[model samples]
Target: MAETLSAPALPSVYRQLLDAIDIGIHVINHEGKSIIYNRKMSEIEDMEKEDVLHKNIMDIFLFNKEEESRLLQALNHGEVHHNAKQVYFNFKGQEITTINDTFPLIYEGKRIGAVEIAKDITRLERLTRENARDKQDARFTFDQIIGDSNAIREVVENARRATRTTSSVLISGETGTGKELFAQSIHNGSERASKPFISQNCAALPDSLIEGILFGSVKGAFTGAADHPGLFEQADGGTLMLDEINSLSAPLQAKLLRALQEKSIRRIGDTKNRSVDVRIIATINEDPAVSLEKNRLREDLYYRLSVVSILVPPLRQRKEDIPVLANHFVNKYNKRFQLNVPGIAKGVQQLFQEYDWPGNVRELEHMVEGAMNLIYYDERIDYTHLPVHVRNKFPSYNDISHAPEALVVPNAPPTKPLQEYMEEVEKVYIEQILKRHSGNVTQAADELGLSRQSLQYRLRKYRLNIRHS
Candidate 1:
């Protein structure tokens, strides 16, 4: 069994315990004599603790510092110095970096000695610089963008031009307008193309989470919070895309603006700011002006972020790109579903052009995906193969030129399931056709290209009152 230590050994044991810690620590009395120099300080200074003991801290640390010694300041003023990063050369002339907190030790409101706690980050600083030098390849290039419409071309040209500079970019468009696609293309075409192109949706998380993710969090910042690097640090020397920027609350917008201006971030629990060379590219679904008026976004932040603004034209405005986008998706899904769909029927192409796609390119992709799933090998996607909701957009005469309201779908994807949307459309179309034929079931069936029996079954299925003429 180990022998128990005597009371006289407690002081030595405490001193050894202090020396075992990785950080440098020391205390100074009223006469500026070292009173609590530890082994870590001796190692950091490359001097023996015995030699520094009973000596003024100023005497032991000789440096041509631009700022006054914080320790001396605290000792004289009987004040406190929080975590401030200080840089200096140690006794061996090696550069030392640390964040220190110093305070005058007081008893009964009377100033006594001063204690200093330091966290040495010299090695971490060096490693960070070295890691930043490593190149990260971007995931997107301009060549991958498929649109050639003049509206899309103009936006693309401006985006490309914006990439040549380091100014922040703001992209705005309706849902499914591919804002992130443009952001990725610009990043890939920029001088920082080889650097990481990280993306995050600002609205995806809560306020506290967004703050912690963007600015990072230090150990003990909160419960279960570790010293984790944020997206800003992770995207150093690269681009970081913040999607749905308007979703960030006003207070968070201010914090983001500060980070943009300072190019540095202080973690949730950290005291010192860490510099990062990250380029920002923010995207929002709403117009900046409108968002500002609604107080959903900060005005100053909007101007600071929209240094180079790019507006992605919605699908309706650039309808000319629909065919190409459709074909591209068709080919993509062909390989995915292992089906050899020869091509789209001309009627289907016409129907696609006639329909005003409110869900934009994303909706089109889903439409094609839905159609492809129904078609077998060697089958051509025709108007009938389209989803019922899409087919319902065409009027009784199969003409939508005069039926603007029928072609108008919501900007967002249908909230209900696809089958429900189809049922509603089928019921409405059957009712419209019945009314068009003056309740003549046979004429309506002929016009719909369905057998009379099928028509009767559909009318019964939808509980529609029909007449036979």
Candidate 2:
């Protein structure tokens, strides 16, 4: 009998197959005690197989009370539960994320324990959170204007103060500056906050149409006239933003001047002038002085509307605000997309600082949003995610080159002093930044790492107007 004992059988192929699996796998008995755990499961739990086997499943691996209850319910009811990319903390206190599928294992028409298969997905979760953050930063807000630069602060302070006035305000800046936003903020901060704040693009409509739209017409005043109230009448006791006021036709300009001077408008084919009480905020992209010299604008109208003139600084002028604007845009896009992008890479930040933003804050916003979407895996955005145009402009510090072709250099004598040449370069860069930040100096200053006061000094020295914020 001692010689007839059969040799111990080798492990079955099924057992070997279970042990070979890469994903964590575990089995619990009917009593909810761990019956078997593969190598992967032991690794995931940071324990030896001998330590986990025979231990209560709820007592060993389930960290949270809710998870323990859920596991018990699944085992008792012979149910299956699946969680895709769930987050957890392990025995070592390190955060772990996984996609898990759990199901009751039944045999011989009787409920056995349950088996759970889990795969680590911690990196995926982190990436998702980063994408969300980038979206959150990209949004537009009154606070998006970043600047401690004195010139920019002065403009913001003035704009904030002007919000309390009912006088017709003029916003003068280069294209891409946020003239309309300033107008809107003033309206929002004024007595007409709750009332309708209407906006009209004077450059987009014909003189007759502009006139008709500004002043209500009688039923038979002209073709298609059905006794509609004009924007001015509708906006009575509120605010009206006139965008591109310099583009107004001569005749329309004259009519507009008359209305502002008289504080009333005469409808077409009407003898009576109706008085309306509406605050006017006008925006002109071109320099008012230049427009006056070209005879494109009437001097009287300019003075009337510019009682509180605000000139917005462009992106290049307030380079200090770039980083702030970039961060803001990143946060905005992160929220919108529900991604967890951490922040811009240091290299990308450097590139942003060096590049000339001709398009201003609007351009920067678009670029940040685009980068968030483009960065599929990495939490941090690098220089590669930026638009080619932006990247191209920012030659590496090691690479020396002239400005891009799109950048124009005024013809200056070659014998110009080094300081004068540098000043010109600075002026161009500032102008480009202003255009990028939509003339928001605070935003530009944040990018350049300069105080608003310092930016103001440079602006004055360069004769750059800092009127809009």
Best by TM-score: 1
Residue 96, candidate 1: alpha-carbon lDDT: 70
lDDT string, candidate 2, 329-439, tens digits: 775675567554556766777777777778877788889898988875325676777777776666473233235555656667979998888788778877777777888
The regions of model 2 sitting more than 4 angstroms off are 1-144, 395-469
lDDT of 1: 0.79
Candidate 2 residue 360 C-alpha distance from true site, Å: 1.2
- Models, CA RMSD each: 31.3, 20.6
Clashes of each: 0, 78
TM-score of 2: 0.55
**lDDT of each candidate versus the true structure:** 0.79, 0.74
Q: Which pairs of residues collide in candidate 1?
A: none
